[model samples]
Target chain A: MTVMTTAPDKRDNAPILSVRDLKVHFPIPGKGLFAKDRPLKAVDGVDFDLYPGETLGVVGESGCGKSTLGRAILQLIAPSGGQVAWLGKNIVGIPHRDMQPLRRDLQIIFQDPLASLNPRMTIGEIIAEPLVTHKPELGKDEIKTRVKRMMARVGLLPQMINRYPHEFSGGQCQRIGIARAMILEPKLIVCDEPVSALDVSIQAQIVNLLQELQREFDLSLIFISHDLSIVRHICHRIMVLYLGNVMELADRDSIYANPKHPYTKALISAVPIPDPEIERNKERIVLTGDLPSPLSPPSGCVFRTRCPFAQEKCATDVPTIDRVSETQEVACHFHNSI
Target chain B: MMNKSEKTALLQSASAAKEIEGRSLWRDARIRLFRNKAAVGSMIILGIITLLAIIAPLLSPYAYDQIDWGYIQEGPNWENGHIFGTDGNGRDLFIRVLYGARVSLAVGLLATAVSLIIGVTYGAIAGYFGGKIDSIMMRFVDVLYSLPFMFFVIMLMVVFGRNIFLIFVALGAVEWLTMARIVRGQTLSLRRREFIEAAHATGVSNFKIIFRHVIPNVLGPVIVYMTLTIPQVILTESFLSFLGLGVQEPLTSWGVLISEGAKVIEASTWMLIYPAVFLALTLFCFNFIGDGLRDALDPKDR
Candidate 1:
């Protein structure tokens, strides 16, 4: 079942998931009978590779397609175009019957924990669903034992198995979600802002728990979030997105310490440093324009309208991603000059 | 020895806490429903009425249609054992009223069940696979809605020759439009919930997701609507029977009984009084139970 595609020569081993030029366009209904149909480009031509056991952070503003990218890779939302190669097999256009088995190894945890779980289902049933779907051969007793063990591992009391989602706090609900996602021991789990809805204290606990479980199961994560600080804590490699396009992609240290793209630099500058003296002295690049609508994004470069150093050439010529360093790539025409 | 006792006490407290935590949504709703006095009273009355309906024929010594020539138009008395008295044709009014209840209650329940199956399936399909399909299905419902309801029933009767089973089917078919609308609305919202997305992510089949996730979440409103719908169906049946289109002769329903009784009101008021009281009481009981369920199952209240 291996898909024949060009494998990057730099990596020693094949990546767990490799997505190239992925696009998810939602067609908007025409306003009039003669009006032309327009498509909302939610995730337009995004490319990335996730190595085994590595956490790839997707950081972007709301509607910037970070969430769409995560969903597109998992095939939750079908991509309008391009390829999603999972374990060297293209899964984007696979039949649902064929995709079912793949789901056991690919799972996702949502942002709003309470909303992500079925209120009618007991906590035990919620966590056991994936196992029941994927491993139907296991006996009832075996399933119950696995559910209890997973519950305990995720910091939920096994005694709360019969309780409903509404009965628990947000953090506990997230733990239940994590337990459900991890019950299958997935190779790659897309954490779509899994901690954004939790309290500040609970956020750390969930992040720490995710890190612990990743080590225990050797899980690769596509952690999508708008919170730069939280993404910085858990992600190894970070990708910055603007208007459904990747503005920058690099290792976490390079992204934060020396951002190559102007948009990435602006995003990093917005994260306030804890030290008062350094924070006051640091320059903040606050671009003056609102984000261009995806319906008709700025001609050529999608981020040109918001880029601080936009030029006449920027409006006409889309800058393709170029390697700025051994581990960093930027998609700005004037990256070296600016 | 004191330390051992303390440990035992702690274990007991922990088990007690677990007991408190184990109360499920259904159990909570049950507790709330039990606490509603009006609902409980309505339930009791409903139970008694149902019991009477089941045993009504056996309880009466006289046949529902038996012409007691000796006691024609007699009032309530012990002489002939006619408690509720004899009707215009000397038939046992009491037995006829009880038998009539069987027809009314059966129609109410069976019609609701039929509607439930049709509405839930139609709505789930329309809502789960939305966009063009949803628009087309709902538009059909809306078209059906525009047709005069009574005329539709009459057309079915005229076309099918007024069978009792057809009455159930007609009433059920007409009533389900509203049920479908309610369920479709609920399904529309439930489909968007993250749980449904999570279910989709798990690669569960669409059929399984609709039945297993969407239906259960929408059941609260559907159950309430069903209770309310039963009374409406019963009333519609009564209205049709009054117009001589429902429950053909020899097999009488409450509606038939009331219709026949209304003609001789001046000569014998008891004929109309008895059946009307029973019908009103049954309708009230259903409404009370519906209200109770609405309050009990409201998630916001919990």
Candidate 2:
């Protein structure tokens, strides 16, 4: 059911990051008895790009490999295949040791604020660690000064520098994370569901802070989340992913105004709009089916098994993403029909 | 990207707000531990025990190996200045016990250090790399662990033949297995941490990541393990000495002293009581310190 994306492509804005055919396969211990080699293809051949100073939101189900893609782009997980080019330089397949200089341009904000940080490191040390590794030439005072500056910008008190991560709330911890990431003045940052683990009210504050910080730093971001509304608020461009494949990619407002893929439709319809009048009027497209295991995903288009528009041809031919219009791209075959 | 003016403003504001700094879990835990009376008391007790262990040879009154023909098993003879009495051959018990403390503490400390070095390094490397290497190393540990270390030590004693140096080597060998497992488990968890990934992304060397970043992260448990490990080695050395396998005859430890006394418990009970009491006291002190350190170093509690 591809009759969704109608917007035009806006690629002329110099793209800052491009990830082509990225795949992250986790070799989970083999099957029963015979022990067949069936790897959990977490992120299989996903393609996307980020232009300068814009947020590219990746929304998906829990096991959709969205987080894996973010890590692979940073070469943290070492993608099994594909190209991750940062400013025309291929970063994949290089030793992590050699990738150090490029690190300043790419950073990440993790989902679990507390787990991601070293509980042993102080707030100042946490922010300073990146600078120490990337900008070792900087003197100790300069490092400390930069770290303090970032902390203050994030709204943390100077006295809190001596405190451990356990002392901070979920929101404060995320601010620390943003401080750490932006301290290096990175050109691109992968935000792996940074606000998912925080309180609801804290989420907006973090999002607003991120937007402001993104603008202040002129940073391009890969905002990974399952929260549709939150994604809609921050991301200029949004990609809907399923299992390990991209289902739809379009401008944020266009997708919200007219979600194309059945999966995207389900995600938007499930947002539980607060206004009773609007909520009652909008029908929820509740698709009853568990997400298929990545280890043995169904044949052809990953969404065919659940799609109401699934046809005989859908099972035999894989749907490759095609630009339907200047503003939208959809993978499903029937793009012309509504 | 932010325009130059806005970027400068952000930087200026950031400079004004630069107040927060990161502190590690270790430092935090230590602060908590300092506040715990029982933990602090244990620390003092263990410290005293360590000091005594190191200074035993310097403080002993009688000569360790000299035999007195006139004072065989003599109890506190003023002429010989033997405060703890004498052994069957009139070798000064007090002097022998002091020298024994030197030998026992040396073996305990050195052996534990050896194992910790071998274990932490091996475990961190294997677990961090985590492939065929991890599988091989872990299975090796599993095989070694399943075998009774005490029996293995006895077999080693018989195989390599018994020697004083062999005792440390054997104990170190067995203890390495334990330390390796502990460090490996720590490395496994620490390797998955975001800071570790952050370190990798920032171009930090693998060696630094393992030793500085990852190992230090899991050091709380490693340290707790080490404290308890020291006592374990001490007890093992004592058991070996009791079985006629440690410190030889001329060189004695609290273990040897206790064994020497155990031989004649039916008669003069002072010999067994002194050494046994000393060994028990040392072990208890270590245990107290271990509990204290665990509480002091707990990240969550901090």
Which TM-score values does chain B get in all models?
0.91, 0.86
* Candidate 1 A-chain TM-score: 0.96
What share of the reference contacts survives in each candidate? 0.57, 0.59
Per residue, candidate 2 scores C-alpha lDDT tens digits across A1-338 of 11222222446675677889989998887758878677899999988878888889999998999988888998888899999888877888987556877888888998899887777667777888888877789999999777766776776765577778888998999999899889888998899999999988889878978887877887788999998888888888999999989999999887888877778888999998889999899888778788999988989988888887788988999998988666678888875664
Each prediction's Cα lDDT score? 0.88, 0.82
Which candidate tops DockQ? 1
Write model 1 residue lDDT over B13-122, tens digit each, in one string: 55345523556677788898899999999999989989998988788899887999998987877677898888888998889889899999999999999999999999
> Candidate 2, after superposition: displacement of residue A328 in Å?
0.7
Q: For candidate 2, write residues B96-152 as lDDT tens digits.
A: 776777888788889999998898899989889998999998999889778887787
Model 1 chain B scores worst on lDDT over the 10 consecutive residues at B11-20
TM-score of chain B of 1: 0.91
Q: How would you encode candidate 1's per-residue C-alpha lDDT over A125-192 as one tens digit per residue? A: 89999998889899999998899778767777677778888899999999999999999899999999
Q: What's the residue-level lDDT of B102 in candidate 1?
A: 91
- Each model's TM-score, in the order given? 0.94, 0.89
